[model samples]
Target: MRPRVLMVGSAPEERGGIGTVTTLLLRHGSRHADIRMVVTHREGPAAMRLRLWLSGTARVAAALVRGQVDVVHAHVSERGSVVRKGLLVLLAKAFRVPVVLHCHGAEFADWYRGLPGAVRRGIAWTFRRADLLVVLGSSWRNRYVELLGVLGDRVVAFGNPIELPASVAKPAGLKVVFLGRFGDRKGSAAVLRAVAGLPVELVMAGDGEVAATRALARELGVPAEIRDWLSFEERDELLASAHVFVLPSRDEGLPMALLEAMGHGLVPVVSPVGSIGDVVQDGENGLLVPPADAAAIRQALASLLADDGMRARLAKAARSTVEPFAIESYLDELAARWRSLTG
Candidate 1:
């Protein structure tokens, strides 16, 4: 029988990568294994909030008690760990089944980055107890080891998977997109600054604390398109017409936007953070610039605008780079890893 995995994470309205990853896992996971998605928070239409909670947590937990679940994957950190995720982990421990902790935040390091004394020791202890700890890149393996040294052997670096678009998007040179939340870490402000004075039109496709992003665009006099939210179809249309994809996040855990843009064949100009090394390969697949450096971003953008060949080559590579992130490959590797761990 296929192993039954109970995957848990935020709902769709949260606008985070974990949600995307979880959705992709379930959509593909069914092919190889029995999967139940336990969404732990509210998203989308307000009226359905209560319904999702009962169906997701209550109905799912009852199934677990009846021996329906074999593995429970917690898609959040241990501290901010919600009730649904925490309960599932405790249950897995009691049942003597394996549990997977997938950490996607840049804050994973911050949890014990430079700590001292007994508290740091406690944090290390919790990490040690994790059956399997998953992270974005091998570069961070040692850092995780520093804190969870005892579980070092159990931890693995698995790059986040993304869906490839049906075909490479044809750039009209009339549009550009920045598809993450507005904030210092995301550095949407920097993307705005980099595109300043350029003839190309721009759209900002998320919402956050920065009312100033709009003001900043106005001050710099760039024609701005701002949307509070976008449907999946609308987002695809934006990606289709966009000439370039720029993610100026100061820190990232392999931003799905960057990967999806690559899937859609939009060249990326991104900061080298998390597992981005797998996605952006400098002048080869896409552009890479120092995060928070508007000048570097501008220069990369200018180069792409001037050279059609460079843009086309990078776009082609971007689409191909995401071939590994397809739904099928993710499910195959995940099932193999689960069997390996449990065997």
Candidate 2:
């Protein structure tokens, strides 16, 4: 029988990168493993989340009592997420089910280091108890080792994966796209400062500080297409037509947006945060800029706008870079790891 896996994280219905990642993993991972999921958290009022925590713990305990779960895959961030999932990890250990802690938070290093020494040590103890820790990129793997003092062998990095479209024909017009929350963390404000007067049409998709972001664009007298949210088809159409994908996030954990953009063959102009620098090499697969730098962002966008040949070269290379991260390969690797852990 296939090993029974329980994935604990944000509800798939939640509207954020973590939700998107969980949805993709379940969709693609089911083909290779017997995976089940429970919601430890969801997007809503704080009161709702509190109820979920109580109910989620009950459900996990029930599953453990029935011996239906062989592995527990807990996705976690810092602060409350860490504390909650740390309890789940200890619970899973008590039940003799191996736990896989998938670290997805972008600001984890800063958050952990800022904690009081006692709290930091407590967090580290929880981390050290996990059977395996999955990170989005090698940089994060190093961070976990250095921060928690966990063995390097137990922490592994796997890029987020997605099912690829058969083909993406270049669409007409110069379209620049940004697919993420609209705030400083995503560097939406910086992107606005950079492309305020650019010739290309800037399409900002995703919600957060919508009113403020729109006001800034108007204040700068730049025409932009700001959509609160895009359906899957709309997102696909936008990426296919886009010539450049920009994300100058102050922090990120291998953003799904950048990977998706690269898969769609849009040359990425991104910050060197998280594991982004692992895939996007300046002047190679894509361009990398310092986080939250408007001038640098402007220069990168300007260069891509003026040189069609350069864009095409980077686009081709960017598309190739995502091949290894294809959903099938990701599933294979995950299944292999699960098998080893269970055996």
Candidate 3:
């Protein structure tokens, strides 16, 4: 019999990596396991967020009481997410259900360190209670075990999944696309600064500090086309037409946007932070630059724009690199993990 897995996280409509992951798992994971999602958070005012958390808590408690759950898999980030998902983990443990805590916060270590010592201990205790902890890559697994005192064996490295595109033809023009939140953390302003006076069309899309990004672009005299959050079809359309994908983030946890861009055969110019270094080999599949460094970003982008053959070679290699991260394979592995715990 298939084990019933209760997957809890942000709402699918929410914009960000966690929302994207939740939507994909719900859409494609049913074949491998009987999974249902409970949204404990969304993007909105504080009062609305509190109501959703309360309601989600009630639903999880009721499911536990009725013996409807075999496992509770909670997706968590830093700050408030740690507190919200920790409650669900404790509740699941009280009901004797195995719990899987999937950590996706890019700035989790820095955030945890800034907390008061007593609060940090409480958070560590909550994390140690989980039967399993899932992270984006091996480095993250090591950090969790060393920093949070989670058992090394209990943490698993699972990369984010993407649907590999079919035979994407190389784009001919010098068009650059950046898909991520537009803020200092994502280095949106730096992208504009780097591409200023360059002979390329720049398209930047995503939420957060959009107005500030636009202002910076105008100040730098960069003719950038800034858009709001995009739907799946819209995002793919942009990727299909773009020759290069750039994300110069200061921090990340194996960004879904980077993988999807590479899967679509776009040569990437990204920063070597978090698990990105594990996936992108500098000068091989893609080019890696230091975060927030406009000079390096410009140099990389200029080189890609100047040489057609190099771009094509890198684009082909980039697509091949991300093939193993397909959603189908990810679901199969996830199902096996759930089965192991239930058995």
Candidates' lDDT values, in order? Answer: 0.75, 0.89, 0.91
- Write down the TM-score of every candidate: 0.88, 0.97, 0.98
lDDT of 3: 0.91
Candidate 2: count of backbone clashes, pairs at least 3 residues apart or interchain:
0
For the record, the alpha-carbon RMSD of candidate 1 to the native fold, in angstroms, is 3.3
TM-score of 1: 0.88
Candidate 1 minimal-lDDT segment of 10 residues:
77-86
Over the full model, what C-alpha lDDT does candidate 1 score relative to the true structure? 0.75
Report the error of model 1 at residue 191, Å: 1.4
Per-residue lDDT over 216-302 for candidate 1, one digit per residue giving the tens place of the 0 to 100 score: 888888788877656667878888888788887766777778877788888888888867875678989998888878899889888
The residue ranges of model 3 lying beyond 4 angstroms of the native Cα positions read none
- Candidate 2 segments exceeding 4 Å error: none
Which stretches of candidate 1 lie above 4 Å from their native place?
42-64, 82-88, 114-116, 150-152
